[model samples]
Target: MNNSVFRRLLLPGVIVLAGCSGSTDPETAHLFDNVKNLNNGEYDRQIASKDAEAAAIVRQNNAASARISTLRNQSASNSAEIKALTSQISSLRAQTSSLRGKFSNQPDKLAQLNQLDGQLVQIRADVGAGTSPSVARAELNRVSAAIRALSR
Candidate 1:
C-alpha cells in the first residue's frame, strides 16, 4: 500500500513539473511577435526616408547642372556680341582719325576732334577689359553721336 501511494504522488508531481517547463504562454508569444513587427516597420520607414532624401539630392544636382549650362551659353553669346562691338568701335575710331586729319587746320574743330578721340579710346579700353555689354553699347552710342556732330 505505501509503494502504491509513493507511485501515485511521484506521477502527479512529474506531470505538474512538466506543465511548468520553459514553454512560452500564448500571450507572451504574441507580445514577442508584435515587438518584432514594430522593429521591422521602423527599419522599413528608415529605408524609405533615406531613399526619398537621395532622390531629392539627385534632383537638386540636376537643376544645378542645368543652371550652369544656361549660364555658360549666355556667357558665350555675350562674348560674341562683345567681339562684334569691338570691331565696330575700331571702324569708328578709323573714321574719326580720318575726320581729324581733314580738320587739322581749324584749331577749334581739332580740339573737338581730340576730345572725341580721347573718349573713344577710353571706351575701347573699357570694352576690351570686359565691361558689361550694356555699358559698352551705351559708350559706343555716345561716340557715334559725337562723330555725327563732328561731320555736321
Candidate 2:
C-alpha cells in the first residue's frame, strides 16, 4: 500500500526531472545529460539511505509499542493480584476480630490473641491501593506498643 502511494507520487517527480532534460543547442546536450545523471545518481543514493534509516526507526518504534503492551498487561495482573490479596486479608481480619471477645473464655487467651495482624490489615485498607507494605508494619509497631503498655 505504501509502495503504491510512493510510486504514484514519484511519477510527478520523474516528470519534473524529464521536463528539465536536454538543451535546445546540440553542443551542451551531452554535458547537460552527464551532469544530470551524476546529480540523479547522488540523489538516489541519498534517498535509499534515508529510506533505510526510516525503516530502522519504524522497527524500533514497533518493538517499543509491543513492550509497552506487555508491561501494561503485567501491571493489570499485578493490580488484580494485589486486590485479591487485600480482600483476603480483609476477610481474615474480620474473622479474627469476631473472635476478639471470645479470647477471654479461652484457657490460653494471651497466646491466641493476634491483635497486631488485625490492626495491620485495617491499616493497609485505610492507606488504600499503591501504599507500600511498610505502612502496615508501622501500624503493627503502634499496635504492639499499645498492647505492651496495656499488659504493664
Candidate 3:
C-alpha cells in the first residue's frame, strides 16, 4: 500500500516539474521573433496599398484643379473681349451720329452716311447675339473703313 501511494505521487510530481522547465533554447526564442516579423511584413504591405490609393486620389484631384483653372481663365478672357467690343461699338455710334449732322446738307453724302450707319447697326446686333470676337472685330474694321471713306 505504501509503495503504491508513493509511486502515484512521484509520477505526478515529475510530470509537473518537467512541464515547468524554462524554454531557453535558441530555436524556441527565435520562433517568437519570426512570427512577429511575418505580422510586420503583412502590415507593411497593407500600408503600401493604402499609400498607392491615396496617391491616385491626389493625382485625380490635381487634374480637376487644373481644369477648373483653365475654365476660369477662359471666362475672364471672354469677359474682357466683350467689354472691349462694347467700347468700340459705342465709339462707332458716336462717329456715325456726328457724320449724320455734317452730311445732312448734301444728298449723296447723306446717303453714304446712312449706309455706314446701317452697317454699324448690323455689327452691333451681331455682337449682341454672341458672335465670335474675331468675326465681330472683322466686321467692325470693315465699318470703320467705310466711315473713313465717307468722311473724305
Candidate 4:
C-alpha cells in the first residue's frame, strides 16, 4: 500500500513538470508569430522580384519581336524596289539603244547617247548592289534628261 501511494504521487508530479516544461508562454507565441510574419514578408519580396524579372523578360521579347517584324517589312519593301528598279533600268537600256541607231549620223548626239548609255549601266549596277531607291531614281532622272537632249 505504501509503494502504490508513492508511485501515484511521483507519477503525477513528473507529468505536471513535463507538461510545464513543454508549455509555451504568451511571449513565445508572439515571437513565433513575428517570425512567421517576417518569413511571409521575405517570401512576398522574393515573389515580387521574380515577377518583375519575368515582366522585364517579356518586355524585351516583345521589343525583339517588333524589331524583327520591322526588319521583315523593310526587306520586303527593298525587294520590291529592287524589282522595279531592275525593270526601269532594262527599259532605259532599250530606249538608249534605239536612240543610238537614230543619232548615229550626228557625232555630238551619238556622244551624248554613249554617255547616257554609260550612266544607265552604272545606275543598273548601283541598283543591283542594293542602292537606295531615292539615289537610284535620281541617277535615272539625270540619264533620262540626257537622253531627251539627244532625242532632239
Candidate 5:
C-alpha cells in the first residue's frame, strides 16, 4: 500500500517538472518571432524596389512620348513648306515656257533668248537647292520683264 501511494505521488511530480522545463535559451525561445520579422522586412524591401522601378519606367515613357510629339510637329511644318515651294516652282516653269515659245521663231532675238535660257537654268538650280520661294519669284519676274523688253 505504501509503495503504491509513493508511485502515484512521484508520477504527478515528474509530469509537473516536465511541463515546467520549456526552452530556456533566448535564441531558441524567440526563433519564430525573429523569423517572422525578417520575412516582413524582406517583403517591404522588395515592394519598395518594385515601386522605384515602376516610377523610372513611367519617366522614360513620358520622355519618349515628348520626343515623338516634337518630331511630328516638325514633320508637319516641313510638309507645308514643301507644298508652297512646289506651287511656286510650277508657276515659274509655266512663265519660262511661255517666254521661250515667244522667241523661238525670231532669228534676231536668238542671242537674247540664249541669255535668258542660261538665266532660267541657274534659277532652276537655285530652286532645286532650297532657295526661298519669295527670292525665286522675284528672279522669275525679272526674267519675264527682260523677255518682254526683247520682244518689243
Candidate 6:
C-alpha cells in the first residue's frame, strides 16, 4: 500500500517537472529565427555581402561629395584665373597688333593665343562636375568665356 502511494506521488511530480522544463523547439509566437539554428553558411555570407555593399555605397557617396567640393573650389579659382588671363591676353594681343604694324611674324602671336586657349579649355573641363553642381556652373562660365575668346 505504501509503495503504491509513493509511486502515485512520484508520477505526478515527474509529469510536473517535464512540463516545467522548457522545450528546445521555438514557440509559434516568436517571429524571427533562433540564431543558433543558422545552418546555411551561404545565407550568412549573402547577408554580410548585402550589408557590406550598402556601407560601400554610402562611402562612395561621401567620397563623391568631397570630390565635388574640391572641384567647386578649383572651379571658382579657375573662373577668376580665366578672367584675369583673358584681360591679360586681350592687352597682349592689342599690343602685339600694334607691334605687328612694324614687324612681320603674325604666326607667333597666333600660336600664343592658341596655347592660352587650350589651357582655358582644360580649366573649364576640370571645373565641370564629376558629381558636383556648384563647380559645374563655375566651369561653364569659364568655358563660355574661353569660347568667346576663341571666337574673337
Model-by-model lDDT, in order?
A: 0.80, 0.63, 0.81, 0.80, 0.69, 0.57
Summarize candidate 4's per-residue lDDT along 1-152 as a digit string, tens digits: 99999999999986665454321332443444445545557546756788999999999999999999999999999999888888888898899898878977899888878888888899888888888899999888888877777687
lDDT of 2 by residue, 15-93 (tens): 7666676543335545545566566675467567889999999999999999999999988976775675566556545
For model 6 the local lDDT of residue 140 reads 46
**lDDT tens digits by residue: candidate 5, 112-150:** 767776786777677778777578668867876876677
For model 1, what is the C-alpha lDDT against the true structure?
0.80
Q: In model 3, what lDDT does residue 144 have?
A: 87
Segments in model 4 whose C-alpha atoms lie over 4 Å from true places: 1-38
List residue ranges in candidate 6 displaced over 4 A. 1-51, 94-152
Encode model 6's per-residue lDDT on 71-147: one tens digit a residue.
Answer: 99998987776566555545544543454444345566556545555654554455342424455446545545644
Whichever of 1 and 3 has more TM-score, that candidate is 1
For model 1, how does the per-residue alpha-carbon lDDT over 1-152 read when each residue is reduced to its tens digit? 99999999999986666554432332443444445545567546756788999999999999999999999999899889988888888888888888977898889988888888888888878987888889888888887888888888
Residue 65 lDDT, candidate 4, scale 0-100: 100
TM-score of each: 0.69, 0.52, 0.65, 0.72, 0.48, 0.34
Candidate 4's error at 13, in angstroms?
Answer: 25
Q: List, residue by residue over 8-83, the lDDT tens digit for candidate 3.
A: 9999986666555433332553444444545567546656788999999999999999999999999899889988
Per-residue lDDT of 73 in model 4? 100
Candidate 1 segments exceeding 4 Å error:
1-39
Model 2 lDDT at residue 92: 49
lDDT of 4: 0.80
The C-alpha stretches of model 5 lying farther than 4 A from their native spots are 1-40, 105-152
Candidate RMSDs in Å, in order, are 10.4, 13.4, 10.8, 9.5, 12.2, 11.6
Best by TM-score: 4
* Model 3 regions more than 4 Å off: 1-43
Candidate 5, residue 76: the lDDT equals 91
Best lDDT among the predictions, by candidate number: 3
lDDT of 2 at 54: 100
